[model samples]
Target chain A: MSVEHVVSFDRRSFMKVATGVITGVIAATSPLAALVPSRAWAVDLGALTDAQGAALLAMIRTIAPHDALDSAAYALVVAALDKDAAASAAVKSDLLTGITTLGVGFAQSPESARIAQLKAIESSAFFQGVRVKTLLVLYNNPIAFAHFGYEGEAFSKGGYLFRGFNDLKWLPEVPLADSGPMPV
Target chain B: MAQFDLNDDSVAVIIGSGAGGGTMAHELTRRGIKVVLLEAGGRLTPADFSQDPGAAFGQLTWLDPRTQSGTWDAAKTSPNMPAWHCKTLGGTTVHWTAATPRLQRYEMEARSTYGDVPGTSLVDWPIDHSELKRWYVLAEKRMGVTRRHGMPGMPACNNFKVMYAGARKIGYKRVHTNYLAINTKARDGRGGCIQQGFCSQGCKTAAKWSTLYTEIPRAEATGHLDLRTRSFATRIEHDVAGRANAVIYRDSQGNEQRQKARLVCVAGNAIETARLLLLSDSARFPKGLANGSDQVGRNYCHHLTSFIWGVFDQPVYAWRGATLAGVVEDENIHNPTRGFVGGYHLELVALDLPTLPLVGMPYGWGRGFTDLIDNYRNLAGMLINGEDMPQANNRITLSSTGKDANGLPVAHIHCDDHPNDIALRNHARQQGTKMYEAIGARQVVTSPGSVATHQMGTARMSKDPSQGVTNPYGRSHEVPNLFMSDGSVLSTPGAANPTLTIVSLALRQAEHITKEMAAGRV
Candidate 1:
């Protein structure tokens, strides 16, 4: 995929960006930028290597992993990391600590090795704290997760009504019974 | 006349600015009192309301739903049951389903109809339902409540026809939709409800009775009321004589500030109200302001709520209209045959949205589920929102060492949910499951434990000072100028939602305070 010949898919195409190219796919000018915080452009995340960014994405992906429908989870995490890189030193340090927790050599490691590292990190108190903080802000923000994965909230969209959208159904019926009051 | 400075200099402070708080501010300020209305939450507008439940869960709700704290942890806390509340300018009314059913006559004195259950503090209200009838009408207008009257499927009158007919077949009367604080047609400059399935998420269209659209603005319009949002009251300031003289608060910027007032109103919800008064300890009143009887945070009650969800063969489009349209009240009064002191109202509450199926539906696996999910449209359900008898053990106390960011002690709450409450819930659950079967539901699922929205009874009102924390007029029995007007003021927990009751009492209390002021009694 040459930069000049970047193929444009419909709104749905953004959901299927490749796994390894997630960072580039979710860069500032990419569709995934919409998922990051509104003030993400202002923060400086400090200097991070490709390995550091990959490790951060792997950790976040485990927390809100992508489903089979190509939810583009990895892309969204990359965008968030890219924006976070521009944040203050404190935020930068927190991001580095999070990346290092999943093991700094994540980019060079195999997928299985990276996954095992993530599993170990999950048991630690520091990772639990980071997981809670990231999820709290992400779940509350619809666009952030919507760019990467499906949320129960998105079922309200028109497309979700019927056509086999898992959550939304058109004119879904629920019957009622007036059994009067209980025999008390 | 008994006047101590009520002019521009006299800080006429009204404690809360929700349904009752905002209404009181409008009423008092309209009569020319410089008022300061304090709300512990942030100020919000209609635009601030989101259709997304996830967003609403964060801003309007007290605790964030996604966090582990959102779920009740029985292992960590004693007597664990997560009590849900709203922490916004509109209070719980902001997220309420807008069912405005008035209490039936028997609800006030359930103790007389059925023998009291031990370990329960069931009592009669000092005032009767008729006393608040006129006030109910007033509250209806203030809230801009509307009804279709005799229209078909109008909920109270018409929609109950099908359910009532079934009930009659089983020897019970019909049910009907009660009055609700929602717009039927555009009234008082707010749009009518679009039936958008987002009332509980905070009505984004200004179609519901949230303080954002009504009394708050009316109070603000008078220029007599100054609302300080995000200002959590740390404690009530006491005078030399141990009367409430001022309110000490922590502002949004976390700065300490004190405002002087002739009379102080504590309208924060039950838990916050008790915590504030108890924290306001002085050398003259060490036990806490107006808490000499140690009844400030005692006698807490939340409804023994339960639900029956049914999966039917056809779609009813349950989420199309109000989450609640009508209710059956036959079992809502006292009935000893059921072995319970009080009764419960079976509300025909419909469900919609993805979260309902995800979070509320019964969890299981396999082939049978596909068929049930295919018929998700045909699932009508009934929920039991029954009144629970108050108990002293169900109290809110302060943790000795735990504190919030502002240095205020954390509210350590515990409740020994009585066996009678459990028994009543069991009976209701059985009845609900049967009703689902009667309605042609293929499968019925019941929630073992109940979630409650109607929290009350911490600071009760009574004619005798020893019997209750506040007098009939909501004034403190011990502190002359201190007043309370939230769920904490209910002497008896009614079967219906508590927001309507709280508003009516606040309206009555305002009248009481103004009358006393006019007669020079303050």
Candidate 2:
């Protein structure tokens, strides 16, 4: 299957979950009420409560904080965890226990306070699991790709041969003769 | 297209279809020999390959459960997945970054040159250097290696430019894009590389040499090859005369089927090749086939490997070229003054944003680790591929309890770094750090060794039957009709990558087999 197809499918499913969850949670307390106004995203959560999912997203951002990264990139981690939790009861329990152990006000806390809270539980299974999952889901997304300046797949666009495979303007130019003689 | 019957006892059965088996199949078939080729994984075309690292890993990697016990870093980091090889039709060739370097003349005579390093089982290869060189020339020509056959070298990418500047700053002269099997210009019916950079994900353009696109197709065109995909060879059955006459394996549907053979060639990589031999124990030769010396699965060597990443102030765009197109060859000499017996090569490497964070750095959270990810565009990476000492204790053995899907015991890999290996790694790391520092790198991070890609030395070749598993021709000392046509027959692991040598040896072995068959020896 094509990578574009897989990525679009993930985006479609996440949008479906986000619309349903936001509608259901709006009547009660908004789970994103604790997050910063500009950074809050509409996330689709299945096994986690709105509060737990919000706290999980906050925890992932704290683990690998990049101010340039969009909040939607961090939300991908929550969506992936929620999907896994829906399929496996063990995953749901781990996410619930880990979010609860981070204690209340984790989503509302400042960056420094959140970092301090995560440091205490860094050795715990819940923390390690979250750290690994965040690396897998957060960094591989298109939003993260843009923030990090990584050009994804090149074959569809005719590869990088003409585009910038050797376009390093900062480095000194290497002599063509240094590459040795060309084939006859 | 050739369909050999189950009872076609005149056919040569080759197990596994990577560099060794795949090349052997084509060589034998073109010579009008009937062959049955068994592959454990399904066939995949260039269209099936994905540029996504994680998705492609799942698509190509051999994920069979294998246990590991070793002092090597892989035991701690990649515990369950010890060696990284493919299970697909083309085997590891589908996943290899095509750097083809021949073994040095001195490297072939390890025992004489190194002077018997204690705690090691090093031996000189039975075949002389000149004989191997003759085959190396043929292998290079057949694979269309860039530097050897007057083929133009690959164009340097941003990653290679960074490496070139740093290496030059460190006063290393013998540095270039290295000899790659990827076509620089359209040749051998394969297109020239566009430098897409995800080479390990299976070259989508078929520019890089892989048996899947090149050798297997050519062999099938000969109409003398019966290529069986998803046929896992479980045991090499022999008659009372101790000749390997049949192979019992599981078909695509997991049904037990036997394919009779005039002779057998096992090239299932070092791990599985040794396992199959050990599993084929019989009443006549109880120790195992060709294991009277008890050295079937010993002296396992996965080259001393580590990734060194240089975080520069400006963008380097490391992931825009051929993944392993640059090399430093000055260190590939045997100099005891460097505090190591054998030597190493520093090849330019690049991992995508997703894989870089996972395997490129140590496992840690917070700003200290995230900062590396932040400067992903400015990262220049190089990998140390060095020769490691061959120890008798470091080996692959069958697990007593663990069983595969077909109810056969799994291969357990056990390795511990020899003191020489540790010393060589330290020296290489120091030199690598110096290279980057000379070019004013902000920070140099040495990542731990990942899963082994250059695995060798499990079933070694020796002049005497008492010392190793196979003879110089990769033929079993006891089972005359049984041969090994892979990196498993390397008596010692050299500093260079093993693909070119594996293909060369298979080519040489095929000629011998043809001569022997014509002489009515079998």
Question: What is the TM-score (0 to 1) of candidate 2?
Answer: 0.93
| Candidate 1: tens digits of C-alpha lDDT, residues B291-329 | 887877788777766556677654444554556666777
- Give model 1's DockQ, 2 decimals: 0.08
Question: Runs in model 2 with CA error above 4 Å?
Answer: A1-41, A109-124, A180-184
**Residues B1-522, model 2: lDDT tens digits:** 999999999999999999999999999999999999999999999999977888999999999899889899889767778889999989999999999988998899999999979999999999999999999999999998877777888777888888899999999988888899988888999888888898999999999999999999999999999999999999999998888899999999999999999999999999999999989988886877778989989999999999999999999989997899899999999999998898999998999999898777876777888989999999999999999999998999998778899888999999998999999998998999999999999999998887788779888999978779889999988889999999999999889899999999999999999999999876
| Model 2: how far residue B91 lies from native, Å | 1.4
CAPRI grade, predicted model 2 = medium
Task: Return the top candidate by DockQ.
Answer: 2
Q: Candidate 2 overall Cα lDDT vs. reference?
A: 0.87
Provide the lDDT at B503 for model 2: 98
lDDT of 2 at A53: 73
Model 2: lDDT of residue B386: 93
